[model samples]
Structures are given as structure tokens and as C-alpha cells.
Target: MTPISSKGRTRGGLAALICGALAAGGLAAAGTTALTPQAAHASSHREAPLISGTPQYDNTDLYAFVSPDRPDTTTIVADWIPFEEPAGGPNFYPFAEDAQYDLHIDNNGDAHGELLFRYTFKTHVRNKHTFLYNTGPVDSLDDPDLNVTQTYDIELIRLKNQHVMSKTKIADDVPVAPSNVGKASMPDYGKLRDQAVHQLPNGAVTFAGQADDPFFLDLRVFDLLYGGNLSEVGNDTLKGYNVNSIALQVPTHLLTESAHQPVVGIWSTTQRRTAHGSYAQVSRLGNPLVNEVVNPQKDKDTFNASSPWQDARFLKNVTNPELPRLIESIYKIKAPAEPRNDLVDVFLKGVPGLNQPPHVTPAEELRLNTSVKPSMHPKRLGVLDGDTAGFPNGRRLTDDVVDAALQVVEGELVGSKNDLGDAVDANDKEFGHTFPYLAEPTEGSRGPLAKGTSGGTDVRSQLGDALQPAGESRNTTLIAASAASGAAGVLLIGTGLAWWRRRVRRPY
Candidate 1:
């Protein structure tokens, strides 16, 4: 794990980065308010009506960034099964045997994967008679008494100009690390986490097992979209949760076709084998919070079922998005004009100067510039605050994407400023600065978690309050520094009040 050092990032960047480190270290922070449901996050975590039925195969989050340690390599992480309680005993979470898990990469901007990494898991129970996951203590991954064990195979396929050119098996019969049941069952979880990190057949590194849910958000965004005050972020609902993660560190040459264009698009998909032999796409994730909040209900299932190239049908949602409209109506602030090309530039196609490839079709996928040297002092409000090495390019674990995303939707990239946001700038857990950056999963017999509001206020709040409420006595304290935030406060209350008035009708 990369050591936590001074990273002179944007205003509140250093603090958020520390939060990420704490999240990775299994730390916690408590607040007066309760941990609401994680309202703000990326990808589809039971977002679709159909995928919601299958949690194991659902892609909860996807993260890809240039390896900070190895500049020549890039690490891609895809997580599944949202909000998994650590204490889920007996039949713990495991990758679906019948499902095909794949990491898709597109180098030329065609929205087609030029290279694909596939994984298929198999479960083995040594002793069917034993009800315990382990008959005794699990000192090692290969413990004989370990009743149930899960393993997988790694297959890499490369396509040049839309035709498969080569296929190779990087590994076979790789054993997965056992779950962190408790102190009695698995005393040393660090060993399990380390043993799970295996060297791939092709020289790449990979790890597949349970880990802490790194994605953090103040769920208070639910009840009313804009009611909660931004002073203190609510508890991280995902702090005590875990997720099934697939982390891979591979070379850049495997993804790109030419050295001229260093940009590549990434996305993950889950497929279930059909009787016909081919796999049917079930779940997909590229960018964070896309299906969760961007798309409407009627189109969510379709978005998950379709491929990136098929995203054209949903382009209407991007050009004139509904989210901005909600922000405008509720915040009572002006949003970017219709035919919002600014959004299309960021959401669909990668920003031209930052991550867009020289020649490519506009599509929805996480675009990363492999050329950008990983920044140690990465900012949470990526791109918005001049931190080009962070998100909106390729998301890093420490990136404060929630705030960045909010600022982007409010036209921050185009120079419009709206600092109002969920005060939760940092994640509940710390993030590692290396491969398999996620922190350890909450143990089954995990001790009671600790919480603290020891950190200072998030920058968005401080910036909004930079100019203290005018001394002049007025009905409403006008925050001159951040006029938008003052109006945002009123708008949020009004929206919450309006919802109360319409109690008779079901709110969408």
C-alpha cells in the first residue's frame, strides 16, 4: 500500500485523499445523522428492474487508472454484489459459476472491445457432510479442512480491426482467498488478502475475492433529493459493507493498437451462459452513477442489457439530460442550455483535450489516458479544480467524484460554479495507493466499528461559507462568496416542502 503523504491537491483535496486512505485502512467516521442508504454512487447496483433480481452478477462499480507505482501498467477493478453485509455466514458470496465475467477494452473508440479478459469461477466442496465453511482454523488458502473452495480461470482474447487474432490462457485453476469470517475462523485476514493476489499466466497481476466496499456516499440524498444540510455529511452507509472485487494489473500495450493514441475505453460486463452455448449480457458498468441516477426507470433495464455501441438510442438522455433539469427546478438555478454538448463531451465522448482519442466514435465508457502519470496528490473534485490526473479521465479510488459529478452537472467545467453538495467529501474507509487498492472487508466477527467527525469541514462547505453570511441583518443570510449555495439551501427546503404537500402521490 502506498504511504499517505502530503499531496498538495485542490482546496479540500488533501483531506478527501486522507479519507480514502482511512477507508482503505478500515477506519470510520461518525456523525450526528444516521448512515442513510448510499444515494450517490456509480454503475448499476440493482438499478435495473431485471438485474436487481441477480445481485451476484450485477456490476456495482468499475474503476480504472494508471498504476501509480508502475507507470508502464494500468489497473482495472470491477466490483459486484452491492451492500454485502460482512456477517453473511454459511453461504457467503461467490462469483456465479454459470456467469461469464469480462473486462472490455476499446482502444480505437469504436465502442467494441479490442481486447477482452474473461473469468469463470468453479466451486468445490471437499466435505459435503460438514456444515461449517471450515472444519477448523484456516491458516492457509490450501487448508485441507476448508470445506468449500472457489477457483477460476483467466482467458485473454485480442481483436485487431474487429477480428480475433489471438487467444491465450493466463492462468487456470487459481484458488480464491477465503472470506474473513471472524477472529476464530480466520485470525489473520491480511494473509488471506495477500495470498489472493496471484501472478497471471501472462505476467499480469490479479486478485478476486471479498473486499471492503470502497464506494462512499451520504445516502441522505434519498428522503428528499435536496433536504439535508451540507454542514456535516451523514454516516457512510457502505462503511460496514463488502463487495466481490476483480482487480487486474495489465500492460498498456495489450489494450492499445498504436502508440500515437494513448487513450483507451474500459467497461465491465456479466454474462450468463445460455442453452445455446453463447453468453447473454446481464449487467454492465463503465462510468459511476450512470444507471443509478442518470437514466430513467423505463430505460434502465435496457441500458444494462445493451452494449456501449448500442448507446445511441439513449443519446437523447445525455444531450438534454433530466438530472440537470431536476437540479435547475429544485435548486432554482439556471442550468446549461439544451443540446448540452458540454455534458455529451464529458459523459459520452471523453473530453477532447484530456482523454478523447484521435479517431473514435462517441460512446459511453470510462476513458483513461494511460500517458498521464498517476498523481500522488490527486484531487477529489477532478478536472473541475484543475486536477487533470483524476476522474472524468479515469476514476481513482481517492477521487471525490460525487462532488465532481455534481459540479459537472451544474456546468462547472464550462465555468459555471455551484458548490452545493452532500457534505460527504471523503469515503468512510481508506484507499491504498497501489495494486488492489481497496481496503480489507469488514470481518464477520468484526468488533464494533468506531466513528469520528475529527476531520475538518469539506471544501465545498467552506467555499460556500468563505464569505461569512453578510453582517447586515436580513430575513435570509446571503452568502456572497457562493451565491449559488445560498439559493441552493432555499431550493432544497422548498423541494422537500413540496414533496410533503404532494404526499398523496408517489414521488419518482
Candidate 2:
């Protein structure tokens, strides 16, 4: 298999036509009920209905790859609900212990293959106190009435030859350790961010807690263009927002089949209590909130019930390499040559481009080429930017996946000289640079900006004027005009120029 390099940009014109086709044909039929082909294969965002209400279990996207921070380990990031608040608590969120989190592999190249590793969370909450407020300014040194403490457990499982084995327990009802549990017994922003990091054995680490959601997009623009109105764009506005996150980093050797064959596929699942009132009934499974495959409100439960168990029949319809011809037949547009072949070949052999005939199986899991070295300077631009860590490998929290999908649809990666015309700003804001991998939330009611001191009414205007685009500095003109001339020469030249211009334009 040829290793795919991440370095190409979408050609403009043809790119636009493909996007037009996708918009007109793919998304035109999208809604709460049915999904179009173009939208089916795109990154999963707002894809399933069950997660619409429960953001934590939504599983909007999943990412897996060799860790750039530590190549010996593999890193997996699971994102839910687009822009969750990083600091929206007194009531912080945690992953459900009963939920079964999985990372699947397909070494055979077939979409349906063997299971690899699975993680289960077992939440153990103790001393559940209702309110956190107290009337007195000072309390007793050993006051049990101060607050309630929380904790949880996590189990890891590995599967081989269809047999399951419990690998290890990362954490047990270990104190739901507060960010600043010891320092002054009150919430401290700095300590909270720092305490979120959890170190594991053998150089592995895990951080699970509430953090700012890192996705930002002007959803209103797309909704207005396609959905006819932006009335439903509630807290979806992207000026500045965040989400709760759970991040894990583990040694790569533990996940790969062997160092010689480093490629692996990945996916995530969540189970909840169905109305049947049986805990044995794992009513929900599959990565929710993604797929962007429209589902009717009536079929929401159907979508959930069918996602994890029915992949061979339901998912293969769109994920199958043979489906593009079906797409062409349905949309009545000529399918581009290279991408049609690329999809078929890659789906079959795990090759990067359609450069080689497929030799792998057709599993519908995210595939990663472990032989490809982890990028020290990772780019969030996804496939279009030539980064393997983006889509087709595994999904990352910060990837600009919409652009990547548009590029693929327009055949940009296949050396096609056509542009996709889906040019949107590429430098949108992203998450931070460390564990939990999200930025800290700014405090106070003002949000991104705080109120001014001294009743300065013009602060907003002054701030706006200073925030200009790159290269045009405020003192550029003054420095350019005065640098070459001596101090007296500058003054004399300025006066002379002013007088000459005034004389020539007087009454003219």
C-alpha cells in the first residue's frame, strides 16, 4: 500500500461545481428523516437524532492515530456536541461508567472484520450532596457539611479470536478529584485546568473532565443558504464557545497488530437504558451526532437501534465503494474518474490514492496508517491539507472537515485540475495546545471581552480599529515617510508638500 501524503489544496473552479452538485443534490434532500449520498459520507455532525438532546453521548466525531507527542503510543479523541461550554459548572460532566467505548481494527481491509479493544466506564458516585452553598463565611476545620465528593471507574478490554479479556483498570471510584481539592477548598481556575491531567502507567495518560468545545463555524450562513432560514441557530452561533471533552493517550504498541503492520481502524459506541426497563438491554450503540445523514424524527429510535448492530446491511449502502455509481445514477451527474476509483481502491486495499488496486477488506471503520510517522507540526486542515491524521485515518477535534469533504467530492486529491469553489476561511479558531486539548474559558458575564473601566465609551471603537488584517501596521505610513529623511528635512518636506497641494487645488 502506498502511504498517502497530506499536502494538496483543492483546485478552485471544478471544486465549486462539485460543491454545487453536492449542495443541490446531496443536501437538498437532507432533513430529520432522509439523507442524500453527498451528506452520507461526509464527516459525522448532527447525524443522529438520539444525541440531539444528550450532547455528552452524541459522539459527533472520533479520531485515532500514532501520538505526535509520543510516537510509541496511539491517541484517540472522541468529540460530542459541537460547541459545549468548557466551564459551565457547579455541575461538571463525566463519562458514563455503564457505557461501552470501543476502538475497532480491520487488518483484513474488509469493512466487517475483527474487534480489537474496548473500554467500559463504571461510575461510582458517593455522598451525593444537592447544594454547594453555605450561609456562614467561615466553617469548622472538619466540617462534613461543606460539600459532597464524587468518583468513577474505567475498565479496559482486549479481544482476540472473538474471545474477550480484561486488560486493566485505569481508575476506580478514585475521588472525583476536584481541580483544586486542597487549595482553599474553593474552585480555582488555574488549579482546575492543571489537575485535569491523569497519568497512566507505561507513559500513557488520560484526562477526563469538562473543557471548552473547540469547534467554531458560522452555521447560520449554511442554514440560510440551504434551510431557508436561520431561526433554529440557537446557541449554535460560533462567535466564541466551547464543549466538555474526554481525551486519552495510550502507547501505540498496545493498539497495533504488530510494528511491521501498523494500520488499524477505529470507531466509538454509547449504550443507554431503553424503555424496556432492562439494564441488560443495551438500547443504543454507534457513534452518534455524526454521519450528517438526515433521519426523520419518527426514525430516531430506528437510527439508534440500527447503528451499531446493522452495519453490514444499512451502513454499507453509503460506506460501500460500489455506492458511488448508485450516487451517480440517483443524482444524474457524471462521477469523476479518479475519486470513484480512489474510493473503490482505498476501500479495498487501504492505499492512499487510487494509485494502486485495493488489497484490503471493506470495513466501515476509520483506518490509520501507523507506518506514517506522527506529525510534530500537525495541521487541522484534514485530507485537503495532506494530513493523514485528519479524516480517512481518524477524525480529530479541530479538523476543518467540511472543507475536506468538499475537496473529495470535487476530485481535488486525484490530481484533477478542477477547483471546488467551496472557498471559505480556513483559519477559524481551534482548541488549545495541551492536555484536555481545549482552551480555558474566559470568566465574568462579558464573555470573550470584558467591560471597560473609567466609563470609556469609545473603547469598543478603538479596539475595533486596532484589529486590522496582517501586514498593515498602524505606524507603517509614518515610518515610511520619515525614515529616509533627516528630522528637519522631514518637517520641511511635509510643509512644502502641504503648501504645494493647497496652492494647486485652491478654488479648482
Candidate 3:
């Protein structure tokens, strides 16, 4: 077991205090600005054209933070399969068996991974003929009634300048928590989730399964940037949806280069098996909104498949971001002057003196100083709010990255610090405080379901009978007809909405 010690606060605290001082003054001034760009923000969710069609392989978000409860370790959580509907039955979400989900670590400043954790999944079905996801209540991971189950293997690979130096299968046959298939099927999803949290022989903790999508932001930004007048602000579009997550908590010593070098850069990637039976990297995510806000349409998919070492190609995108120009066009705000080195420091390279590595390569990564202790009371605005323990240092679930990124993109670091946001401040569900700290997945039975549906209630009705028979009272028949018409109208609206969503490139 690693020794418990509070480390790096002297440097981290002083740096945070200085950032805090600047944020305090700038935030207060920014408060009075009339232009709040709520529509100009979103995280990585179906951000690219190709990934939108393949939710199973799309890497939605990646979070890395020093364990708040157990500071001796760092926990990294990578989520996939964005926007899972709770009631989607028959076949709920599962980690793709033909894909490789990876978490990459760059301990030195070489812009390439020195360590890589690869996860591969395999699904099992108890009954081949059965269409049901579960035959009966799944009280445990090994329940015989659970027809469809998933297990995964994790491999730890040591790399030297992207060359594999060693490969070891750290854990295998670990149960993945099943989807929350309503109360009737999974009576205690929480218990099942706990059971999936396996403690490995190497003092690492691993969990893989469905959890509430922790990234929060007004995705309505795509709706004409919040209806152009900010009418679509303040609502968390991702509320109630779920995502398949793979989490790992390892000893702090394992991630650092040495005691003298405490900084580490992390990112996640997904490689899908191609038709030739070879895997091709399809999706990559590190810092939030990089592909969505920083990269343009032509290069969106390109960035996803690229390695950090080759990030110099995308450097111009950061220095001259389209987000600020778009903001300038819609609102009257002046875009930050070009060759924006401020953004280069904050996004491409980690902020100097805070999370930046010594002699670092300019590349994208969720850089974290593992020695920085978790904040007792973490601020949502993250480093901008002076809470260096949060985002940009490495994202905690509670960090309000949408607001933080908006302000930073709008020149918060270059002295123009104002709170420009999507108006959605926090996650709709509260996150847990344990090893796998995401909120419980929203159950299919977690109600306000269809109008008359209730637990075990029969919803079957005679087709068109509710419209009233010809012999019924004239007034009653007329009223029934009116009700049926209203129902039909609602159905049409819903159908049209679905079609419209499909038409958009980044619907989720």
C-alpha cells in the first residue's frame, strides 16, 4: 500500500491563490457584462460527424482526479456510449466487444504515452433464443437470471516514447455492472454496482458499467446557439441519460515519472475493429470541448484519430479558435487577438507553474499534478475559481467546465475574465463519494413514465376503443374524439422531433 501523504500544496496553493485573486476581480467585473454566451458551450458528445452514428464507440468524456476520499491514489474514469435512454430495453448498452478502450498516460513531457491501460470486453448470453436482456431480477452480477452479462480484461503496457517496453495483463474476467433495467429487472442496481467494484491484486480498483453521464452543459447550444436569444439556456440537456464507464484507481507512485516529477498527462481513445479484422483508432478525448469548439468540421474526425505527438498540426486551431470568432459574430464582443498564446498555454500545453510539466511538449492532455490534494470544497469553475484541484489540473465530476472553458476561450486568462456560460452549472444528479464516484444510472422505472403506466400496471387497451363507440352519448363521443386528436398531435410532434435530431450532426 502506498503511504498517505499530503503533497504539492505549497506550490499548488500559492499558484491557486494567485489565480484566485485574478478570478475574483475579473469575475466580479464580468458579472456586469450584458453578453453572457450561454449558447456557446458544450462538451464532447456526438461532436464529430462519424462518431454521432456509432454511439457504442464514441468516447463522450474523460475525467481524471486524485481520489478525494483516498488521496494516495488517482482515479481515472473514461465514459462511452453517450445519451443512453433509461427505458431502452431488450438490448441495453454494453461496452463494444470488438473495440479497444484505452487510457493513456504521459508521465514525462514527450507528448506520447509512457503507460497505457487497455480494456477489452466480452459479452455473454445465457439463452441464445431469448430476446430479453434478463429473464428475472438480477440481484447480483453472477445471477443466472441475468441473460446478458459482460466481463472485461485490463492490460497494463509500459511504453518508451510510444514503443511498447512491456505488457502485462493486470486483471481479467472482471464483471461489468449491467445496465439499470428498471426496478422489476434489476431490483438493486446499487448493490450490483458495488459488486462490480473489484479490488485487484496490485492494489488497484477497477469498475466498468453504466453510470449517469457526469458531463453537464447546455447541449441546446446547437439549437441556433440557444435559440439565438438565450431562450434555451439553463437546462442540462444530458440530464437523466446514462453512459458506459470504465474506472481505474491506482497508487499515485505508479503514475508519476519519479518523486521529483509529479505531473502526468492523460487522455482516452477508442479503436474499433475494422472490416479487415484490424483495429483503427476512431475516437480520442482528453480535455473537454477540444474537438467540438477548437477543431473545425474538416479536421474534427482527424483530431480524434491523431496522437498527441502529432498535435502540432492542430496547434493553429487552438491559437486561432473558431469559438471566439463565432461569439464575436453573434454577439458584439471583440474576439481575442490572434496567435493567442494564452489559449496555447491553457489548453494545448498545461498552464505553466500550475499543472504544466517541466520542458513540456505543446499538446492536448488532461494534465494533473497527482500530488495536488483534492479540494475539501471544490469549486465548479475549477482553476478559474482558484480551485487548482479541479479541471485543467484534471477534471473532477463537479467542475463546471462549460463555464470555465467559455471564460478561458473568451480571454479570461489574458485579463478579460468574465463568466460566459451555457447557464447549466452542475450535474442534474449528485455524484457519489466512493471509489466509482458517478451518480447511479437513471432506472427505466424511475418514473413519470407514460401517462397511465405504473409498476406492474397493465397498459394494454383496445385499439381505437378509447375514442368512444357510436352508441355512446353524443357529448361524450365528441370529447373522446377531441382527446384522441390531441394524442395524435402529440405523437406527430414527437416523430418530427426525432427526425429533426437525426438530421443534425451533433444531436446529442
Candidate 4:
């Protein structure tokens, strides 16, 4: 059996990651789903029709990794609300008071959340009958001028037999960071962000706020689906979009059952109160683009409400994905055959000895091996580029899942590098490289001149060094430029070991 070594990581043979796992029957682990391949970039945006109508409960993205800044702890960031326009006045984004946000971990590989982190919100309209979100310049998160404010309660629950065995509210009535309307209302947005950070008794750090969207991708790929060619200039559609984010950082011991099995599966979900007062799940996401690309139109909603244990039904989608065929349609290349064992290994069971749990039972999740040390110089292309700490091992804010997923979808392990890409490489704002790493949201209403505003551009832009060739030792690529209104930054980096790209007939 080909051990699921980082063999493909050193070369462009990512398909081997699957090939090896297939030999081991990695997909037999169970509770796995067929996900979207080479089709889209963003992970879980408005994936289903119902979620499209309810942005508040929609989970846009989920990132879990060893905290680069604090390797002793792990960071799991789940973003809600999509494509928020900073200038949207009156009522900016807030965690839906009636909704329940949750992060699930399956460390023991039961395809169930052995531990669950739940967040519930409550909003207070301090200034009733006021049209302004803020009556005056909001000097701080607690400023009286900020009329609409929200507070959240966080709970860490232990689950057994799909029931909560114990639930502890880690933090209660923690105030949410007010939205960054603009310089006029928020003089120092960073201070507001700092004020929102809540320290819990259990040694956990949590933050909930409106922040710049860190998901980077050219969203225009969905325009044609399998019919047309992607526009050469499909810019990163998510640029400038802000989101409601919940970031939690906890010690490694809190996430894992024992040091012997440090690998864990991660997923985020949202539930809303129905008229009957019962909560109903509206969205769920683990890996990127699974719901958006894998589930058929009719089943997208079903997939959202389904559980990891019931994911076997969707296995056909992965074993027989159409994403490669779609790429082949435009490029006239030979696509992989049925039972794409490679994808099953990567998306379902995870790479063995890497992110795969010791006794995993096959589930769709973003798996991370807690034992892996945070890399000093990470590669965005992830395992494909030979980075131990990148995506498929546990994703970081900097992991280019879009590019990695695209290559894996094309059967890179089988020596197929369709070289499909969105061309949008990096994020618009600078990631903090610390807790709640996503950059601050773009200014909307304007108060004090915020830092790093050179012609409305931030000095530490996430997209600053993207789309460039991957270094033999370190790689980078230009994924996106600065947002027009917010921080207009640029990025440059590329996938590992670039090969000759053969552009087929331009379908566009």
C-alpha cells in the first residue's frame, strides 16, 4: 500500500495522496460526502437556496489550524454573513440574535462532535427610534453613540450519543465588536477590535465582530458552471466584502481526547429559530466549495440539514465527480475515471499520518493533526507544494484552498495538472498573524483617519505578495488586489513547481 506520505507534497503528484488512501479503503471510514471540485473557490457561501435567502444564518467559511502565532493553541474561525457592503447604513451586520452558531470537533473520529462550541447572541437597541447606527463618533466599543449593540454567550459542551453530556458557558454577555462604519464613527477600529476580545476562565480567547472577509476567490466561475469558459479577468469577487466572524482560540488539550490521537475533524453550522420556536439548521460547512460545487441543485439544502453520519448517500458524488469532466469539456483533456479514489482520500478520510485521525470513520471535515508544528514559512499551495502545515493538514487563513482544491480535483496525483485557477490569489486586507487573524473590516462611515490608509489602502495588505512563483523553499501567488474602498492591497504567490500551462480553447 502506498503510504499516504507527503510524497505528492514534494512533487506535483497529489493524486497519490488519494491513491494511497484508496488502497487502504480510506473512504470506507464513513459519513463522507461528495464535494464540489474544480468548480468554485469559496467554501460555503449561500450554497443552498434557503441559505441564499438567509445570510445571517449562512456559514460562509470555516478555518481550523495550529495557531501560527501561538502553536500551543489552535484557532478555529467561522465566518457568517457574506459580501457585506461596509457603507450599508442604518443596520450594519450583526450576529442574528435568534440564531445559534456552533463549531464541532470529531477528534475521536465518530463523525460526531465530541465537543461543541456554541455561540448565541442578543442585540440591544440602546437608542430606540434612532436612524443612525451611531449618534456620534464612537470612540470605543462601549461608546454610548453606538445605538445598536450585541452581546453573546459562549458555551463548551461535551456530547455523548448525540446528546449534551455537559455544557459550560465559557463566557457570558461578552460584547460584540461594533461594525466599522467608517472613520467618522470609529476613530480607532483596532481599539474596538481589541476591546471585543474576551478571555474565558478555561483559557480560551474569543471574538465576534464585523471583520473584512478573508475568503479569497474568483467567484465568477459559477457563471458558466459546466457550459462556458472562465473569463480571463474574473477578478476576485469577494474583495471588499465584509462578514460577521466568530473566532475562538483554545489550548490544544481542550480540542483533542489524548495525545495519541491528535488529529481532529472540524465543521461549522448555523441554526435559526423557526416560528414553532424550535431551532433548525440552515447551513453547514467543513471543506471549501463542498456545498457550492458538490451537491446538485436539488440536494444542496438536503445536504445542509444532513449529518455526517448520513453522508454515505453523498459518497457517489465524490467517487464520481463531474468537476474534472467539466474542466475537460473546455480543455479537451482526458478526465479521471469513475471512483476518483484520490478525492475520496483527500476530502473524506484525509491524508493518513497527516490530518487523518487514527480511527476515523470517514466524514466530510477539515481535519488537522494537532501534533504538526506551525510552519515558519508556509506554502499557500499546501500539500501540493510540500508544506506540512498548510491546508488538508488543517487550513490557515493564508492557505490557498482554492488553488489546492482545483489541482486535487483535476487528479494531480495521477499526473493530471489541469492548471485550473480563478487567478484571484490573495486577500484584500492584511491578516493579523495573531488571534482573530482576519484583517479589520473596511471603513464605512469614517471617523478618525485609521492607520495604513495610503489612498485608502492598508500598509499590510494580504494580497501584497500573491501570484508569484512558489519558491523552491517558499511559494507565493498574487490572488487579489486591494478593494477599491477598503484596503486596496495586492498579493503574489503561485502553486508549487509550476509546469507549462496549456490554455485550451477559450470558452468565453
| Model 1 poorest ten-residue lDDT run | 30-39
Clashes of 2: 45
Residue 13: error of model 4 in Å? Answer: 7.9
All models: lDDT? 0.73, 0.44, 0.79, 0.75
TM per candidate: 0.78, 0.62, 0.82, 0.82
Model 2 residue 263 lDDT score: 71
Tell me the tens digit of each residue's lDDT in model 1 across 1-508: 0111224534443223323433453221111011221111237667789889989999998989888888788899999998788778898888899998999899888677889999989999998886788888888888886778899998898976558989988879887876678777888887878888998744589999998988887655554454522333445656788999999999877777677788999999889988998888888888988887787888787777777766766666666778777766655668877665566667666765678776556667899988888886776777656677788788888776676777667665454645645656677778776678888888887643312243332334334323335774221222332244444664455455455757846766
Per-residue lDDT tens digits for candidate 4, residues 1-508, read 0011222345633445555756776354442433322221126777789889989998999999998878889999999988899888878888898888989888887677899999999999886887888999888777898898999998889997579899987889999998888887787899999999888776789999998899987776666642264444336678778999999999999889898888888888888899999998778888888888777776788777776756776777777877778767766657877677677678877786677776566668888988889888877777777677888887888887877787777777655654556665577677997788889998885323354344655333443444335552222222233333243223212221222122233343
Cα error, residue 362 of model 3, in Å, equals 0.7
- Tens-place lDDT per residue, model 2, 1-508, is 0112234553333234334434454322221112212111112344455456665555555656566656676677665444544344444454555455444544434333254344444443334555442212213312353353334455666554445644667665533323222223443545555555667777777755444444443354244322333233223344344443456777777666666666765555555544574432122322222244323344444544443223333323333333224335543434556324333223222334311113443333466766667556556554445555554455555665444443354355344433322233332445555555555543323332234444333332333224445675534432344443335554455556556857887986
In model 3, residue pairs whose N, Cα or C atoms come closer than 3 Å (at least 3 residues apart or on different chains), thus clashing, are: none
lDDT of 4 at 293: 79
Q: Write the per-residue lDDT of candidate 3 for residues 1-508, one digit (tens) a residue.
A: 0111122312233234335534555322221221211111124688889888999999899999999999999999999998999988879899999999999999986678999999999999999898999998888999999999999999999999778999999998999999999888887889999999999866889999999999988887777666776677888989989999999999989989997889999989999999999999888998998888788788887877778877766766766788888777876568878766666667655766778777677677888989889999987877776678988889999988887777777776665645578877789999999989999999987764443554333232212324546786634443344355555554445455556656885756
Ranking by lDDT: 3, 4, 1, 2
Candidate 4 CA-lDDT value: 0.75
**Deviation in angstroms for 235 in model 1?**
2.5
- Sorted by TM-score, highest first, which candidate order results? 3, 4, 1, 2
Q: Between candidates 1 and 4, which one is better according to TM-score?
A: 4
